[model samples]
Target: MKKIALMGRSEAGKTTLTQALKGEKIHYHKTQYVNNFDVIIDTPGEYAQTHGLGHALALYAYEADIVGLLVASNEPYCLFPPCSTCTANREVIGIVTKIHAPDGKPERAASWLRLAGCKKIFYVDSKTQEGIPEILEYLKEDGDVLPWETKPEADGKKRANELPQEESQ
Candidate 1:
């Protein structure tokens, strides 16, 4: 499964999403520091909110296969600017939480993520497990391979971890 790093503003449901993904009972737990799990990295909202600590999130992004930029449906403002995903070397996706909130505007939140360059966006209400299966399916996909790391086999299939042989002079 692809390792994912979740980043968002305070009360964005990063911790709740982490628990739901792990199949643990959802509980309220403040994330004071980066929690590195086997397949997930849960970061404190302060890291994303404070300009000085934002660098820490970038550093952690390196350790993940996918970087998830989360936004609550009811947020009045977006923290990320246009084309924010360009700064990430890894695949960047958007997760819109609180889809079932009384005053939520999921579509608006999704638009913000789209502007930020998220190739794909998912709407989830962790409390009810909505959209959770889709996330699981995404994580189960095979990790990406660099062009130089794959070699074409005789069967016309690309195989990873096998470099092409050099041509003889």
Candidate 2:
């Protein structure tokens, strides 16, 4: 299975994004599907610095072909963490969450996250499903850029929704 771990503060819509990607309502957990060449392991949301969540993240990365880090755009401190620590392994792609807002611009959001620590960036609305395909394409392109075989701890993705999640307590 290609493991994709979602990270954010609790209730940041990490779970919601995964469900929306599955084309389901935001009331379910642990759905599966066959992709071109991935088992697509989607796990429960991981809150920052939780040992269980961290362990789960490490385990998932250890088995992941790629990692997708989701960041809520509306959060004022979105890039405050500076970069994705787990993604330092170099396989992490980022998604800027809640792309559409009355005053929020996704392009600017994407740029900020890219600077935070992402070779590839996408803007997506987990609630409304905008930019999902674009996010997929970006991931595919990143994969294509990689060698035939990829190692673990290589990719990281997180998500946030409504307003972006605060970085620290």
Candidate 3:
């Protein structure tokens, strides 16, 4: 699975979203520091709320395969610039959380993410696990065949000829 690094504000539900994606029960846990998990990297909301800590996300991005810029549907302003300043080599995606909020504005939040340079965006409600499957599907698709990877068939084994030259030697 492609590891996801979540970037968002304190109330954006980054930790809850991580639990939802992992198929765990939703629970409140204040993220004080960067927590590296098997499939997700949960960062403190201060990283996005504080301008000084914004650059730190780039350094953390190196530890994950995907960088997810999160925006809650109820957010009044865009934390990200018109275009993403992230310098990570990996793909950047967006996640709009708290879509179930009464005052949530999914459309507006999605627009902000687009302006932030997210190639793909997902809207999810962690509490109900709504829209979570789509994210899982996307992550699965990412494993299909990377540019430098060899395609694997249904079987559990790879043919000798299918191995890369460097590995074959």
Candidate 4:
């Protein structure tokens, strides 16, 4: 699975999503620092909220193969601006949390992420495990292969662990 780094404002459910993805019992755990798991990096909301600490998120983004920009459906304003994903070198996806909130507007939140240049967006209610499987499936996909890494055999099968052998003189 690809390593994913989640960034969002406080109360956006980053921690809860992390727990759900790991199949752990959902519990309230305040994130005070960057929590690096095997395949997930859970960052504190303060890192994304405070201007001075925002740089830390960029640094952590490099550690992940994908960056997840999360926003609660009830948020009044979007923290990210238009085309913000252009700044990220890795793949950027959007996650709209709190889909089941009383006043949640998931579609609005999704539009904000779309304007911010998220290539893909997912709607999830961590409490109910909604949309969790899709994210897992995406992570399970194989990453891009370099052009020179391997070649398909005559049977159209690519060897997983073998590289092209150099020709002998």
CA lDDT scores, all candidates in order: 0.92, 0.56, 0.85, 0.91
**Model 3 worst lDDT window (10 residues):** 142-151
Better of 2 and 3 by lDDT: 3
TM-score of model 4 vs. true structure: 0.83
* Candidate 3 segments exceeding 4 Å error: 141-169
Alpha-carbon lDDT of model 4: 0.91
Better of 2 and 4 by lDDT: 4
Error of 3 at 79 (Å): 0.5
The best candidate by lDDT is: 1
Clashes of each: 0, 13, 0, 0
Tell me the lDDT of candidate 1: 0.92
How good is model 3 by TM-score? Answer: 0.80
Candidate 3, clashing residue pairs? none
**Residue 58 shift from truth in candidate 1, angstroms:** 0.6
- lDDT score for residue 100 of model 4: 92
Per-residue alpha-carbon lDDT of candidate 1 for residues 24-122, written as tens digits (9 for 90 to 100): 899999999999998899999999999999999999999999999999999999999999999999999999999999999999999999999998999
Better of 1 and 3 by TM-score: 1
**CA lDDT for candidate 2:** 0.56
lDDT of 4 by residue, 66-142 (tens): 99999999999989999999999999999999999999999999999999999799999988989997788888757
Per-residue error for 93 in candidate 1, Å, reads 0.2
Question: lDDT order of candidates, best first?
Answer: 1, 4, 3, 2
